[model samples]
Target: MSRRLFSCFGKASSNPNHDDKATTTADLTTEEQRRCGPVVVELFSSQGCATSSEAELLFSRLGRGDFKLDVPLILLAYHVDYWDYMGWKDPFGSSQWTVRQKAYVEALNLDTMFTPQIVVQGRAQCMGNETEEILSCVASAPRVPAPTFQATFQKPTPESLQVSFTGALRTKVDQEGVSVMVALYECGLVTNCPNGVNKDKVLANDYVVRRLEKICSVKDISAKKTLSGTVNFPLWESFNPAKCGIAVFVENSSRQIFGSQNFQLPDNI
Candidate 1:
């Protein structure tokens, strides 16, 4: 059976109760600071999918700098390749992302995978286009242990970019496993679809993931081991440094994200 996409619309706003100052102020305790960690939202979508355009717009608005949210919001749009053969091909679609979505389906134990599906903090799923449902999930999301995460990017050569990250779990947990994942995303991406269900429509996408790379994995949580790695950037010919950034996150065996951070690329790079 073909999967159906859900839709809804409303004015965008941030969580008011979130304490952004907790992260920067010395007055707050460690627990208070961890409460300020950003919520990670992953949207599995495709340009060729009939209902994905609306979800793309919703996510774009949420990722905007001027949205004025109290808590940090980290959004990633992963385009899947499964729909490309249906007349119009999605330029950003990737088979790797398709596999990623499938992995989520298995983790969530869902019978089927569909476009315009939003996964919050890698722990909850909702209809991508429904602002209320998405926000509700974000608000009720369980607070996971925060980890110290840092990332840096530089253009080593005209044809290549280099990225490095360092992280250490800050709190104790009894997880069976953990893995660090890094994603490269670009904003202000525009595409004009001449065919398919969205024929003749222009779509704007934000935080659209260009590549996702795994950094490392951990088996023992009791030990405080620092995780670090340097990787060559997955260069996209159409990438604009002004609209690109990186997100680093740590996920456990059950696919629950414990911590995450987002960094925008330097303008000159």
Candidate 2:
């Protein structure tokens, strides 16, 4: 249901039983000077949506390399809070994610926002559960050199974790209002839904966004662009470094992503 149930309207695949249909072929390559990075696939989902389980499952497969994709993928799932009022209060849900999704809604010129939506490189979108369409979007998205960054982790306090990163852009980049967005994500999560649309269900989620921070602003990322910044994340109960990781990407004013990279958090952190 829409946050404003009466006024908000959106489109979704009427066919939830998405099949393993073949997808449109794509060939993406770059000059040797600057090779392309992995595709950044962002899924807007909620644990409260009954229909989101399928999409979540598919995302797990994509993250775990269950599919033989030509290009690599850096997957992230943002759980929005609008569905909370329906019954189940999703522990992962947040209004910040809702704002982020709305930004995509405006950028894509969509009628409204919808759950189980996949935005590829911030350029193309499709129903999240539609396997073929999702792969097609990934295949066709424009490519760019992967963003490069080095994460430095500091000793953590009981309540929060602080980390810093230094990055460089070695190739031609032509985007304004560029920002570095860092996300702390988790995998292999299982939740027992006790209320609402997903009542009495055991749901699994991966690449779930636990924290998102736009760490720095760079007016011009072309040429030898260099930047460094730090972000602090509040710790959650039962947090395990082994299950968490970081994803870094570059995005422009239009919210179109150019490249992304993922780094695993050290177990000793």
* TM-scores for every candidate against the unseen true structure: 0.83, 0.88
lDDT of 2 at 150: 84
**What lDDT score is found at residue 38 in candidate 1?**
77
lDDT of each: 0.74, 0.78
Give each model's clash number: 0, 0
> Tens digit of lDDT per residue, candidate 1, span 46-163?
9988889998988988877455655677899999887887788999998888888778777776656777888877767877888888878776655554567676778887767888
Q: Which residue pairs in candidate 1 collide?
A: none
Q: 61, model 2: CA deviation in Å?
A: 0.6
Tens digits of per-residue lDDT, candidate 2, 1-269, equal 45663111245532212112111113433453146667899998988777789999999999888889877889999998888887889899999998888888777767678888898888788888889889888877666678677889866687788889887844445444577898999998999998998899999999999999888877645646667899999879888889999988888766777667888888788
| Candidate 1 Cα outliers beyond 4 Å, as residue runs | 1-35, 65-69, 173-175, 222-224
- Candidate 2: the clashing residue pairs are none
Q: Name the weakest run of 10 consecutive residues (lDDT summed) in model 1.
A: 5-14
Error of 1 at 225 (Å): 3.5
